[model samples]
Target: MKTNFLAAAAASFVVAGASVASAQDADAPWEQSPFRCEPGETYVMNVMVSGVEYWFPVYEMFKQAAHQFGCEADYTGTPEYDVNKQIATFEQALAKQPAGILLHPMNPDPFVEPINRATEAGTAVVTFAADSPNSKRVSYVTSDNAREGRVAAQQVAEDMGGSGQYAVLENPGQDNHDRRVAAFIEEMEDNYPDMELVGRASTGQDPNKAYQAVLSLAQANPELGAVFMPEASSAMGAAQAAKEAGGDIRVMSVDVNASVLDMIQAGEMFGAINPNQGTQGYYGFLLLWLAKHPELIDPMNDHAEAGFNPMGIPVLDNGYSVVTQENAESFYWDKYLKKRGTRGIEG
Candidate 1:
């Protein structure tokens, strides 16, 4: 179903007022759950990014969780968004053979065998951010990407009155981006038949390319009602292009960058989906660490009569948030910043 953006934005203040009047509870899960690790327990993490702001918070969260668990953590990744490079890093991580490895697989297929090899070699392995769904990885930590896409599409369709031309900004051929786009298109086709998806362009997570894509779409289809970007960098460019064009096109995207949050607060952006990057890193590592030490988790698994460690699940749903002006203040980065220090938010 579609949502009324104007109505939601307007009512947010009222809802905030009501919640404040009702209760002042401040207990969140992150604050309650203790970090699970032991002293001298060393871990290594490999991410997939080229120093983008999006991935840094995730790393920081992972580090913070590692600290809480009394484990040492290290993060390194490629300078560019290259699957081959990420694969090489994964191989290198296997070489160092730390207690466990947290990886964000670049592709869904090629990383499967290597991840299996890592797990078989007894190096507790888990996937984060993105996953190789077919691999033997212990846990897959990430926001529900498909659900995020479906939500974005539903919101866009509702905002546009369920009819009009729309476009998508994708991250080249990335599997995560592909999954999101596919879900969005499927949602539109199955539910909002009146909404036409006219264009799908790749921005490569570069602002200029994103700008060009949105600019081209707006120029080609002046009637374009909304645009959804699955990546944060491209979302920024889409907002700029939408602003420059001065059209009715509403913008929606994924992730929570400081600037993006500000834009959403100022009503410049329609809304943003926050996958809680910090939590992803924190929990991704926790699962891997726990998998390595079955003693700690065996009780819960055995009590529930569950199977052995790793769970062998196809995918793990980390979580996501639909951030708007009303709740932006509550979702601060202090916890992540405190652990990562200045370095945490910088990247």
Candidate 2:
């Protein structure tokens, strides 16, 4: 009886050992595990203005997701706002044949060919923040620009007692910015009957240009109660101009950085509409990974034969929130960086 019991115990141990070995083999970096990355398989997060603090949080989460899957991640982009320079940087990244790319195309049309080319070459490309709709990119992850603009309009109009003149500073030709501006105007015209759009200026995201534009708007429309823009890069100069012009203008925009949060906390500016940037980074990576491993999907459609990505998702809205004086502390970039214990995007 003792010998028989020992034999059964040894057999059970062997089965458990084999199970452990199989699991470890499945997770080996040298092998292509369904959910794990093979050795040297790297994914990249590419943006237009690499130094902008806005992209850092996004990259932080992107890097976190990559690490979870035993994959490598890198951040690359041009410091300048020039689309050509960004495209050049993108081409350089593409030349390496990286496993995947999460790109924020500075513009849509100009990126179509490049995005399509990358996908055609079997490298998965997923766009974030902005999109190249006419391209073969797998998907886009972003907040709804139209909804963000509408919310901004409502907040500004309510702050002005629902009857006032407002101006808009713009970055023309950028798809997301254009959508936000268009939606802001439409919301004002449709819902806030008492509010009037006094003027619009293309700031081109240059703070000095925004400064000049706000000053000109304040001078041209003496009753201007507020000024809105699609992004926060120009908000610093716009707020300064507003302060110079008696500080009553509600200077608001979308997205935020360290300075913007500080300005909000100090009441130097009204508020900001900020996107959920972490979601953009985290889910953006997932979409890119899934697109790269399309064989995991046995969908009804024959995406491979059709020369299309199997994910087939056009866009995703990550959602956003309003950043005001009461909650501005939670959005401070420095505080977040301290907690994260990493350089914004340098790592």
Candidate 3:
């Protein structure tokens, strides 16, 4: 389904409105008797890498959902980008016996054992952004990564007059990033034969690495028309390099932060794909809560399954938008929240 970018941009406020409106009515869905969390029960959001500006709105929306459901949510992850460290942290969180977990696994393989243990121990697990499909995780939530890549490819190729040399900055070994880069290349090969992929580099979530990569790529391929990355951190550095190199190479990426938004506004970036991060966090918690308390939703089902049967292992595509200078201001999480009259995490 095609996403309504403007509506998706306003969705967080719509959720906030529902929260406020639900507060006044005694029969509100959130106030229903069956879905309440037990005393002392809490939820946790875990990621392999933390400390990026992109995660701030995600955790804020997660906290908002937890508050609505009368539960607490905490964030835990390693800043080192090591899958082993993340697994250790996940084990540590599991030891506390949280009501559920929202995980963003860095790699699919390293998380299988931990997710299985969490499921067997009765903690509901839902992955977001990145997924571990082989594990017993109940659900996975994310924007359409392949679609993001195709959209970026089409936009860049069309802007470059359907024929130009391009390069990709990849975050290697991450499934989501791999999907995006793969789809981007596939789209270019299938539709834009003239748009040749001149180079590929592994930036690995570091802006400095991306900066150097872009500079090196440009130095080697002076006729390079565009560059694409799966996330914003690399785009930040890539944009700076393009600026220093006479602003001929266009940069495109997925996800947005203040710096990326500013770059777009300043015409340093071609565009970006913005996933529904608020929905990822809010519904991620909802799915985990329902998985933990299947009885709450069992009335709608005829099956006689009992005790955390995972409800269903559904994948949710939260949708995304291609953000350009015309609407770049509205895509900023802070500005979106402020315009919606909702306070951010600090507020």
All candidates: TM-score: 0.79, 0.90, 0.87
TM-score between candidate 2 and the true structure: 0.90
Worst 10 residues of 2 by lDDT: 2-11
Better of 2 and 3 by lDDT: 2
Q: Write the per-residue lDDT of candidate 3 for residues 219-284, one digit (tens) a residue.
A: 999999899999998999999999888899999999999999999999999899888788778767
Clashing pairs in 1: 37-69
Q: lDDT by residue for model 2 over 138-193, one digit each (tens)?
A: 88888889999999999999888889999999988899999999999999999999
Top TM-score hit: 2
Instruction: Decide which is better by TM-score, 1 or 3.
Output: 3
CA-lDDT, candidates in order: 0.74, 0.86, 0.84
After TM-score superposition, the amount by which residue 140's alpha carbon in candidate 3 deviates from its true location, in angstroms, is: 0.7
True lDDT of residue 276, candidate 2: 89
The residue pairs in collision within model 3 are none
lDDT rank, highest first?
2, 3, 1
Count the clashes in each prediction: 1, 0, 0
Q: Candidate 1: minimum summed lDDT over ten consecutive residues — where?
A: 1-10
